[model samples]
Target: MGADRVGSGRGRVGRTGAYAVCGAVLLAGCASMPDSGDLRGVESTARQDTQVRVFAMPPHENASPSEIVQGFLEALTSDDTNYETARKYLTTAAGHTWRPELSTTVLEDAPETNAEPVGSREEGEEFVFSMSGSKVATVDAQQSYVPVTGAYSRPVHLTKNHEDGQWRIDALPQGVVMGKSDFQRNYMSVNKYFFASDAEAGQSPQPAAVADPVYVRRRVEPMTQMVRSVLKGPTKWLGPVVRSSFPTGTALQAEGDALAPDDQNKLTVPLNARAARVGQGRCEEMAAQVLFTLQNLTPAVDEVELRSGGKQLCSLTEGSHADAVAALTSAQEPDYLYFVDGDHRLVRLSAGSGDTKAEPAPGALGEGEKALRTVAVSRDEHTAAGVRLDGKALYVGALVSGGSLGDPVLRSEGKTEENRLTAPSWDVRGDLWVADRDPANPRLLLLEKGAGEPVEVETSGLDGRVRAVRVAADGVRIALVVEKDSRRSLLIGRIERGGKTDGRPTVTVRELRSATPELEEVTAMSWAGDSRLVVVGREEGGVQQMRYVQSDGSAPEEQAPTALPGVEEIAACQDDQTPLVANSEDGIVRLPAGAQWRKVTEGTAPVYPG
Candidate 1:
């Protein structure tokens, strides 16, 4: 620990600079040093305040078992491409057996090491070390980040190497472990775009790109790794609901160097020959997919040029080919925001004009044929569905000037109002979704084209009764507010569909995971963007608040939306320019970006087209 002594391994200048800084920080306090000296340039590897790279230092001669464990932990946080230096401290067998790619366990801070006293009769054993910490979250092999809460403790056994007489880890976990701050510095989350199946694999007149987010190393040729991750297809959790535009077996042309955007801010992607066979239209879509994925990393990328086998296939310009890959949520581009007026009639405010005046929808439902409780507009804005104010029935009608309302499309068998039908939601495919709260036969129903016979969609792995439902614009995911024991939790589920069974298509909601597990109650929620949602909920013993959460149960980069008190229902879309409308104590309120909420009208259940 002498100031003159510097550690060496890999000869990294940053490691040396780090030691110098540590020495300065210490000597500046305890020991008296020259306060003023001739300013001189020193060898430093850090180019900026934030871009400091930490390099791993190998084990010192005859280090203790505790020191070995601590050094290994630090190595996990270093920016080693292949982790070859980190593995140097381990015995050949232990190094060969370790697998750092399986998963990542993030803790609140560096794990503390404690060694048990060696009083055993065994002649050769050195020590048994325990590494423990407060758990924060875990990243799975699929690279999905899931926040967790618990205590983590693990044992590490070390024995003297027969050949080198050095203590090495003989038993340890397979994956890497690091602190949250280190994890943030080492990894980043990015969304890879894919086309939605729309409940059918190959049957759709149109298309929209859905986001599947995954985490990857930040400083280690991330663009190259991301290209491969996209070609590998969606993660297991999201795979069933979405389909990638890239063909199977498609991969980046192998190159040993890092892939980076060029001087003109354009990226040239070389793909395998599989991509060369695609038609012009399909190839452009492929370029769009890559462009979308890289946008999360390098927003300034102006274009993405795709090539295969030394042949130019196609190119996608950010401004010109942006529509080549449409965001599932904002595909239709909502023109009006819908809500129920004080008179219990469906009304809308034109989004383009930023109009505050409310006008009755052209349909009969808007003409007061039936007092409305809640409403959902189709993604196309061509149709509307409404639940009865009494919550007994659901009906669909057009939003045109002469549109007529029809008989109830679905009915709830619930005996009381609280046990009746929930508000309706429309997917991008124009299907209507609602939950029947009948205690005897509680069910989730879907109507094709908003007017077909209602079918009970399966809710697999569900633990509570669904209180409300909102379908994503991709039409393959659904968000539910499930109630159990007087508490409501928000869960995101994948919608799975099968071939027709007795002339009816079979549908199921699978793998319902909590989008807001930290919250004790979720009162209202809506699809705010592709793979993002605006949620109104609260933690245990905490007051209610509104925030944006990823569909995969991760926190979004954007902070909580403007907080409005008494929010009963909240609505948002992928378009940030569009104001967020909500039903609050001030009646119907609209919040433009960076502005306070203004009363739009006296209404409830303000919603944009999903």
Candidate 2:
């Protein structure tokens, strides 16, 4: 529906500038001035150009009530510097009180408006507008936005004054309403990184960066808004898992000051004195947070400088410890796709495999007696976790030389074997996540590398059993395949970590939002990007196929990519740019970038580092 590029809006500035220089200029020969000077007749064409953009203005003063209503709705889709033109159709009092920034309601298509001339339009009239086709998501007051699904309706009240028969809206909804295509053109998604509390709460060995994606106004000062959002802290769903390094009261030293990249691509941010008290370690952490957030913008910033009270308190470069923190946590694609072979042993297929032969992994687990049903590899590729075929046990061991698969790390406590456990997922912090799924004691558990017992994660509002669980690379959000009402639905739950008094960390999950409400059954899903997932399911009457859906249940205009035939299982990492791998009936197939899926002979339970 719109340009499919992520940062296409920024390209318009250069194109607009070129047009201003060539077309927006008036010829010097056409200029005439009353002067007696000799140069008056000999006109030199001096270059004088200014950027000009056409804007939608308010309706005429004598316009009918319906005309004014239509003009107002069209203006809502424009940026127009704080929606200045859109307010023209509103009464002076209403214009001053209405805030279009509070939230934005995304509609399926253009709204249908009908005006009812109440009492001959003397006492004023009302216009009712109804829109259909799913309402996707709402951006809240704090700019925290989540995916949602529903229908929406609103009414506009118009009044006519005696002096000038000008029809203007007196009251309406507080925020702006637009369609999905317009929202994509006017808004952008950005991920702001915050430090996970695992290390702080004694759960992990060190700190890791967690990414939280939010939509911001694309034409507005997005870099400034991104930094301000980071200082404001993570969204409500993510607040429990991550903590901002900036102090609580820390804010921009100058209000509305945007962080612009210098010639060196370094962003200098001026913060209040509240951040100056932190030591060098915390200062770097604060800088890392800003760098990771702002780097998502167009022409990404390579480094960050934190300033306070007009002095440079700290300057962090891209290769520094803070800049490297995020890279350390995210999973990178390995050279091989590791899985189990028909011999009940661990094996891998090389990236450039001309032959069909598969090689055994360099570890004892590859040659162990236990038959693995499912396997999950850690981000570092140094360790692997596997669940027994019977689902009664989980084993974790090393993937390097001199490493051996030892005793089962966790045993299922379910009364029956089928109710034992689901596949295990590993987070960046070297912790494993699994679901017991036992009807007797159905719950989620987290296993730290060296902890004595698996910590039970509190899951609220979970109606059905968690059939499958996958932790995002950020370690904040989790995707669960929940079986409820004899069907499966994809739900996204936030992971919250709390500090306990006994020096142990407490983890809980809250507000499980459905990502595929229209689908009657979702068989499998994997994280394709930071805020998106590729799900295999049946939507209403549609057949079971792989579709790309947002993490918040919102749908994009572009159709889903072609489904891989006969694929029973799929695997993708957090980085959406990488190719997707699937377990097909023929063999393991890999989808390269812009290429068809090709079969890689002989493997089961294929997995990428997550």
Candidate 3:
């Protein structure tokens, strides 16, 4: 969120009304308080080039206490190295103790500073001032950030220095707070990838890289900071599901690691002796983790060399076999959009051919007695999992011409039919995820392809009903629609997979967080991209609407497409560029690239291969 609009001439970025403490009485001993309103000369930087970094302007000679306070607050938004210039308005002791890196509270708009007199300003005495703003998010000391709703207030104490008659702040908050615009201008959003704990393992392994997005200082050794953040492990929210290839307590060398890439795009990472002690296999995994993490930089590092004690331990290139981790796990554009037709047959529309014709998928599944209520295709587009029309049984079968549907792979034990199985989603690993909402035995199950018993995954702290489930292509995160106390929440939880316990896959969920708190009800949702979800829901007493929200619960202000009439279900791939498919009451509709929704066929549930 940015500044609120004030008038038609000034544009949307307006001055924030704030409260502040003024300087000593200019005429007498009585200091005057500045009005929160009518404070002028604070212009918007909207017309300025956003790409250029804005540095804090230095305080002029012989500035008053109020002027010094206002200038200091404005300087907090600039790209001052170590905030050295910003500290010019603070006393020597306060400047040394004030740490701008402790936290960053992003505000909704430009904050106003009101200079109110605290008490009788006896000459050469201490003065106090306070500042506040409506916050959007707060990034903590550990760099764990979360979207929040509330106000942020803090007080600063200033005193006259004995060396000169100048006033300087002696005490203040530990960190700096800035507006969203400045945060965007000074900080860059970057993602560091880590391997899923149970990523695919075989002769030719393909481990999925889960992205953890964080904001780092834009120009101040960003590449170095990115590497340091990776060493710090995943963010708080994603730490539970993902694991670092580096051993516990592993980190970049403390004294000399600056992480600058050489001219040929090769980055030599200096690790402690601990990393060099690992075996070759473990070393390669660590290299893969570093390669994927550092590649997100603008001047991408193409190769990584790990060294310890001045000796090379391992080296990796972008083409290394262990580096086959897919960046964004979206489906390769397929030729068809498959669903169940009105005749209870598995049918597909020729989406790739730009044709509106519907045809049967293949042999038994297309023309058999087992009618599918909902279906999900694997990333390879060869296998599919379907739930029966009665929602009691699930079948896994091939999608080719002569493939036959298998017997019930999973059966619901719900006491009532309405509490049966939901749509099944297939990850790139070929594992199927579905929820059995039998109130008595409600559980989320993961079925590995070609496996017998579906492994029941436990969801700790999820008290209500699990209505719908969608697994991301990475296979490490799952989206859930949970209903509790008549309130529905769209939550994203990390998939904790315990590798092959007793020759069987074991899984659980942790770090559940709501993605869309503004919506009162989440009717349907699908993964639109790696870190975003296209959600369809309604506010209290509002009509059904469609909006895209980040999995981290930070709602962007993008305008959403209007809801389709009588829409029942929606499906999308992890690529935001891909078209969206939805099932309306009359028929299935397709939102092709840059086009409006058009009727595809008469169907109920539409899905793309994960």
Candidate 4:
């Protein structure tokens, strides 16, 4: 950073006459001249001594008239006598009236004069002197003595004439203020000429101008690179077989879309405008995520409804307005709302009631009109993940508050760059736990609030691609599905406190496949209590069963799997131990602990969980 310098316009003038007088007086005795010059030199010596003694006397003393005059002149001319001493001499009204102009004139001409007097005093005292030859011509010459401080210096003049054997002063015929105006015109004119000449010659005698600030431009590229390194580094060095197992093409493209626009700028976009664009993008991304994840479903329109507990909460689709999207992903703490559609748009949503509006559509980019996606609500609702097609990656949106998905709460997105997120679970603190199914680098990602980036926990060592992930009732323990070659396994992991591996924190994983070695792979996992986790999977014979595992990595115990009656897909409640399942052919089912499963709703379409 640079700053401008402030200048105090002030100038100083040196008295050359005073220096000469002091030197001459000091060298008077040392001169070796002829006898004819010696007499004149002696008289000069006496005058010089008298002048020095008179100048040394104080002002208040009752001295002779000549002595008083000499002392006044010395005091005025001495550099030691500052502005304060000069002000004191101007005691009488007339003296005060002339002081400012007299001071200005003396200061301006001091350097040019042979010997400068401080000022003149017109008291009740008189002195008679005779001026001969050139002296008389110099006094009577057509020269103006313009006082620097007075009004007459501009266009004024002063003339002297011998009257009654004394020189008298009077204004010139042009009617100018003699002392002030004349001096001002000359002083100002000189300065103006100097400055104008320097400026026109392009000679910048002053300092340079300050520089401006730099804005952040490339955000998404760096973020994408960071994610790619974190997720793909270790596996890329593995054999080609491992790399081939990973999904490519559309998955990478979709991940790239989700991580777009990654830079942060000091200048802020309008909250309303940002909110609308992000909301629309979020809806589009989420709809794509959900529709793409489905086996064969294709969306005829860009909009969809978000449902909770068998009731329609809000629509996560775009409307007639450009900013209208049905869903948004956001964080609960420090409450940040972000759009999850490919563009990472965000805005802060305030607490209020009624329909929340969106921004207008963006301008056309090319020949085609871009589809604008936004989230809208009939009432308040909590938004979860928005997944796009081809099973590559999705945006995980979680609500942190105790409120149901139908209520407004904090929202956030869990993003994956290359791995496909098959299942996601949220802890009590709102941190997201996601399971990715890339065989070479299968892992669970923990997205914590305030963490600069998501942390990945490798599940490859546990033996399978994760099919489902769930946090225990205590929120610290987690359950995952691992498949080994052709057989599926249930792996229970406790959230480790101080354990770390390879500079990263580690979760303690304990295999629970002893009692259910016949089980192929876990399809879903949920917590039953603070110490127990419920696991669901199908045996080699294709019969699905539910089992329970302890947090300490204990062996598994068989528990009767809650029959969805006719539902095929199931999701556990984040806040409680109950599970909600839906049958593509029948209706929605709710299975609470120790209670027979009950049907929540029966509709033609499948009931989806947010």
TM-scores for all candidates? 0.86, 0.83, 0.81, 0.30
* Model 2 lDDT tens row, 103-159: 988765545454445564434544333323457678776665666677676777787
lDDT per residue (tens digit) for residues 365-477 in model 3: 67755887888877777777778888899988887777767689999978776699989888767888889988888888888873479988889777788999998767788
What is residue 517's positional error in candidate 1, in angstroms? 1.2
**lDDT per residue, candidate 1, 1-610, as tens digits?**
0011111211110001111111111001111111122211111122222244456677778766656666676677666777776687677888999988889998877665566535551245566666678888888887777778899888767777877778777778888887777776667667777878654311344466777878887666667877888888888988987777778899888756556778887898888877878988888778777876776555446688988999898888765356634443443357899999988999988975568899998888789899999999887787888889989989899888777787898888788998999888888777889999998888999998887788989999999899999988777889999999988999999889888988998999999988887888998998776667888988989998998887777675465777788999998875555677889999988887677888887999888885
lDDT of each: 0.74, 0.68, 0.70, 0.29
Model 1 worst lDDT window (10 residues)? 20-29
lDDT of 4 by residue, 341-361 (tens): 223221122112111231211
Better of 2 and 4 by TM-score: 2
Instruction: Indicate which candidate wins on TM-score.
Output: 1
The candidate that achieves the highest lDDT relative to the unseen native structure: 1
lDDT of 3: 0.70
Candidate 4 Cα errors over 4 Å, as ranges: 1-383, 396-419, 458-461, 497-515, 546-562, 565-568, 573-587, 592-596, 602-610
Misplaced by over 4 Å in model 2 are 1-54, 122-134, 200-206, 256-258, 276-278, 320-322, 325-328, 331-336, 350-357, 400-406, 413-419, 499-505, 555-562
